[model samples]
Target: MKVNGKVIVVTGAGSGMGRALSLQLIKEGARVAGIDINEEGLRETRDLTGKASAAMSTHVVDITDRERVEALPAELIALHGAVDGIINNAGIIQPFVPIKDLAYDRIERIFNINLYGTLYMVKSFLPALLERPEAHIVNISSMGGFIPFPGQSFYGASKAAVKLLTEGLYAELKDSNVKVTVVHPGAVNTNITKNSNVEMRSDVSAEEQASMTLSAEKAAEIILNGMKADKYRVMVGKDARFLDLFYRFSPKRAVDFITKKMAQMAKAS
Candidate 1:
């Protein structure tokens, strides 16, 4: 779908990929409503945009809150007069822990934000989206979803749910104007790790992490192009593409390799 002049709502629009995408969309001529639980981050995103008024709006919201999620379209509609698309990007990664040892609260919190949050946003805006002759929904999954790493099982599970959910939407909406796209990104340079209690086993030094990771701007560009192309599954970054293939070629071998590498890294560190 053409982004120009489109009415778009982006969840998690406060920072990282969401913020970058919101800025890009505004540059491309789309009216944007940026939503996030972090009001300060939302304000920061607003400040980055070129125009103070054009295609720019922000809201503070928790996607896990069903009532609040449902209210988004009504609120945006009240202001913009219509809705055109939804980008379900808000997600959370829990701390590194084996599933058996993982805290119930941590696991639940991850799902609430990553999985159910996307679902709620999709359901809330889909009715309005379908009314348009052409509409779009973009859901952000992760490379972890395609292949679960040992310590980050919960995060993988939540994103795995998103992968399936987006695929299912595409299947169901094949006859309709609505298009669904899922993005899988690997190790992007974002505050995602700092925001969560999650730890990395890769022995990646802070500086190394800074250098190797993809920027949020590049990630946004990949997703934007994928959405425009109506791609059902979009993979971003070299690492993400590699994981996608490695997992498919040999799941056990790939998992075992990651386990051994992470363990070796932790021991050496």
Candidate 2:
């Protein structure tokens, strides 16, 4: 569905792709309800909007809090009059360690925020979305969701659940007015490590890292274009696109390739 004049709810709107999505949505004449756990970050996002900030509203709520998430539809509708779309963009990564070395608490935290949080937003906003003449849901999975990223096994598992959840929702809603899209973004330039509160052990220079990933703004643009076209899935970067095809051709080889890359990065760091 076209975003113009629509009231779209974007999670993780404090920064990264979420902030980029908000800015772009407003630029395209859509009203945005930006949600994030960080009030300061939300404020920064709003400030960045300048005069167009009036077209956006910022909500400080953790998607993992069921009660708070449940309350969002009403609050958003009161402010924007209606809800047309929702982008489940808030997520974090696990510590860069093998699953055997990962703690139960850390595993639970990743699942809670990545899987359950996205689920809660879907359940809460779906009814409101259904009320619209046309609506859309976009869930951000990751390249890791479709392929193993050695150290981030659990993070990949959570996003993989999201990938299936979104696809299933598409099947269920195909006959309805609501459209569902699952996005798999390769590495995008964002402070996910800092935001996730996990240290990334990487000896790769900043220039090398930047060369390897898509910018947050560019990723958002591709995602929005996919949503406008009502696509079922979108790969946000060339790395994501290439790896997807490679994995389909030979899963074992793809896994081995990633495993080798992980080992090299580990040794370099």
Candidate 3:
């Protein structure tokens, strides 16, 4: 569905891809209700909107809070008059450690924010979306959701859950006006580690880091284009696209490749 003149609710709108998505949505003539847990970050996002600030509203919301999430649809509709689309863009990565060394609290936190958070948003706003003439739901999964990255196993598992959940929603809502799209983004230059409260140590040179990751702005553009076309699956970055094909062709080989890469990264660090 075209975003022009629609009201879109974007989670994680404080910074990174979410902020970029909010800005781009407003540029496309859509009103945005930006949700994030950080009040300062939300304020920064609102400030960055410039003249388009009027087209956006910032909400400091923690999507993992079920009650708060459930209250969003009503609040957003009251503010925007109607809700049309939702982008579940808020998520976190687990600590760069093996699952055996990972704590239960960390695992729960990752799943809570990444998986259950998406679920709550879907359930809360799906009714509102259904009432609209046309609506869309976009969930941000990761390339790790499909391909294995040794240290990020749990993070990948949570995103993989998001992948299936989004696909399942698509199947169930196929005949309805509500559309669903699942996105798999390869490494993007963002503050996800800081946001997730996980410190990352890497020995990779700065040049290599720049080459591997896509910019947040470009990632948002790709996502919006996919949404406009109502695509069922959207893969961001060349890395994600290549792996989507590669993993499908040879899952074991893809896994082995990632295992080796992660090993090298660990050794370097």
| Predicted model with the maximum TM-score | 2
For model 3, the superposed segments whose C-alpha errors exceed 4 Å read: 205-208
Question: What's the lDDT for residue 182 in model 2?
Answer: 100
Q: Candidate 1: which stretches are off by over 4 Å?
A: 199-206
Query: What residue pairs are clashing in model 1?
Result: 31-55
What is the per-residue lDDT of model 3 for residues 1-269, given as tens digits with 9 covering 90 to 100? Answer: 99999999999999999999999999989999999999999999989989989999999999999999999999999999999999999999988889899999999999999999999999999999999999999999999998889989999999999999999999999999999999999989989999999988887766787677999999999999999999999999999999899999999998998899888878888
> lDDT tens string, model 2, 150-209?
989999999999999999999999999999999999999998898999987677888999
Q: What is the lDDT of candidate 1?
A: 0.88
Ranking by TM-score: 2, 3, 1
- lDDT for each candidate structure: 0.88, 0.96, 0.95
| Model 2 alpha-carbon drift over 4 Å, by segment | none
- Of 1 and 3, the candidate ahead on lDDT is 3
Residue pairs whose backbone atoms clash in candidate 2: none
lDDT preference between candidates 1 and 2, better one: 2
Count: clashes, candidate 3: 0
Candidate 1 lDDT, 158-239, residue by residue in tens: 9999999999999999889999999999889888875565665665687887789999999999999998888888999999
- Whichever of 1 and 3 has more TM-score, that candidate is 3
TM-score of each: 0.95, 0.99, 0.98
lDDT of 1 at 121: 96
